[model samples]
Target: MIINAFILFLSVALPGLLLTRMKSFSQKRIGYFLVFAGAYLFSMTVIHIIPDLFLSEEDPFKLGLYILIGFFLQKILENFSNGVEHGHVHSHGGYSIPYLLIALGLHSFLEGSIMTDSIHSNHRPDSVYSHGSSPKILLGIVMHKIPAALALMALLVAQLKNTKKAVLLLLVFALASPLGLFFSEFFGHSDVLPERYLVIFFAVVAGSFLQISTTIFIESDPHHKLNWKRFSISILGALAAVAAQIGF
Candidate 1:
């Protein structure tokens, strides 16, 4: 767990420092960054989180419910975020920063929770490191950081012009996921990590991804109807998630 948190911390912090360099771009570039980050995280969730879920002893019905539950919770978050995760950086009178920071922190931690939970649930001391989420969770958190980091860095550069402040904010952003992982590992070790709670948590993760992706689509191209491309891709994401749930 310690190793996982450390790695996750670096994953998030590095992107933040990197974001300090993107100060001259137009809003379009910022939006593009958000799109890229969202896409990247979505892919990772499909490719990683879903598979973890499948490998665990969780059942199909429960998994489905988790998805629905994730969907709604993410929806609520989106409403509060005003679609920030989708790429549009609408400031709510300077309230956006603190609100976003807190939201991102919560989001990161939950994601990390999924990883640590997986490890503790499935791994024994003699087991390979393959089961612990320290790595994948790290990747997901890093990937998740890109969008927010990009937006935050760009804004900071445009106005604050203080690399130090930008970097500091970025570190704060990076810690969110690791913090989540910390709680996950802690709760898991207490022998109190109930299956029902995990099911709900997984549902939230899946839902957040779905909500963010769909929100991006709606914001980017509202008239864009659900064509085969989106449908197929979404199904692929769902399948990937399902497979992860059952340990495949």
Candidate 2:
């Protein structure tokens, strides 16, 4: 679990740091890649996570309710995050730095919590071939994080006079998700909470995934015109999501 958390931490932090050095990197180019990530996240949630959650014959309706809660929870988080989770960041000067950090941190933390179910499944012998959420979800998160971290670092650099201070703030945001994962793994193993609760939590995360991905697809091309490149990338993403489920 620690190893997995560390990988996720790097995924969240390293890209922004690298972006700071790559002066030639284009946000528009990054935006194209983000479309692929968004599509994969949406496809994975709908193809894998949601079906797994609804598979529970017991109180399936309750799982749906939790998903709705998660969807709204993300909407509220965006009020402060400025849509950073979906790669939306602006250089506007009037925004509150503290509020932005808090919102991003909370969203990252919730994202990490979604991994607990995967961790638990890894410990079960029978789950080896079971249909469950794939670790590829981590890949999707990391893919999105690269652009998110870039946007965040850009915002921080624009707002703070000191480079080191901006980097430090970025590091804080990076740690939020891994910290959430670590805590969730610890508590999950302590046997304090029932496994059923974890399922509901996963469902909630799925809801958030749905909301973010759909928003990205809709907003990525505001003109609503047919763009073959993006459309093909999105199809590829969905294919990748399906392939991941088949032990790719």
Candidate 3:
């Protein structure tokens, strides 16, 4: 768990730190990366996560409602984040940094909260999968986090106008996912979250993934036309998710 948390932290921290060494982050490149991450997130949620949710949850309708809640909840976060999770970080002169960090941090926290190892998933002996997500969900999170971190640092540097201060703010944002993993595990082991609530949490995060990924797909192609290159990248990303599931 310590190692897992540290890696999650680095997923946010290292990318932002790299921005300190570079003059600017490339939006064109980040857009392509977001497309790939979106494909992976959408694919993983459809295959691994949705199946796991159904397996652990008893009431399908109730679970579906929570998923909807998470879906709109992400939309609400975007109002504050200005689409930071989507890798489109823009600066408004009057924007509040606290609100931006809280919005983005909540989503990151939820992403980490889903990392308990088969906590409520009562799989058969022959079954090879667990609840929440496959271990390789870490890869998807890191993939998305890299660009988000880059965008976030870019915004912070512009807003604060001091690299040191921006990076310091980035450090606080970086702690979010690791803290989510830590607290969730700590509470789950201590029985603070009953088995049922654990499933609910997973369902919520799955919904958020659906929102984030689909928004990326839609916003990436505003003209509603297929770009063959992006289509190929999307296919590759889905393949990566499948490979993660089957142990490739």
Q: Write the per-residue lDDT of candidate 3 for residues 52-144, one digit (tens) a residue.
A: 777764599988998998899999998898888888865444567899999999999998887666454454434545533536788888888
By descending TM-score, how would the candidates be arranged? 3, 2, 1
lDDT by residue (100-131, candidate 2, tens digit) is: 89988888887887766543453334542343
Q: Which one wins on TM-score? A: 3
| Model 3 score (lDDT) | 0.83
Can you give the lDDT of residue 127 in candidate 2? 45
lDDT of 1 by residue, 152-241 (tens): 555555546677886787787767777777776666666687755665676678767767765665654567765455455445544543
Model 2 clashes, total count: 0
Each model's backbone clash number: 17, 0, 0
**Candidate 1 — what's its lDDT?**
0.60
After superposition, candidate 2 runs with Cα above 4 Å error: 91-93, 118-134
Clashes of 1: 17
Whichever of 1 and 2 has more lDDT, that candidate is: 2
Residue 113 CA error for candidate 1 (Å)? 1.9
- What is the TM-score of candidate 2? 0.90
lDDT of each: 0.60, 0.78, 0.83
Candidates sorted by lDDT, best first = 3, 2, 1
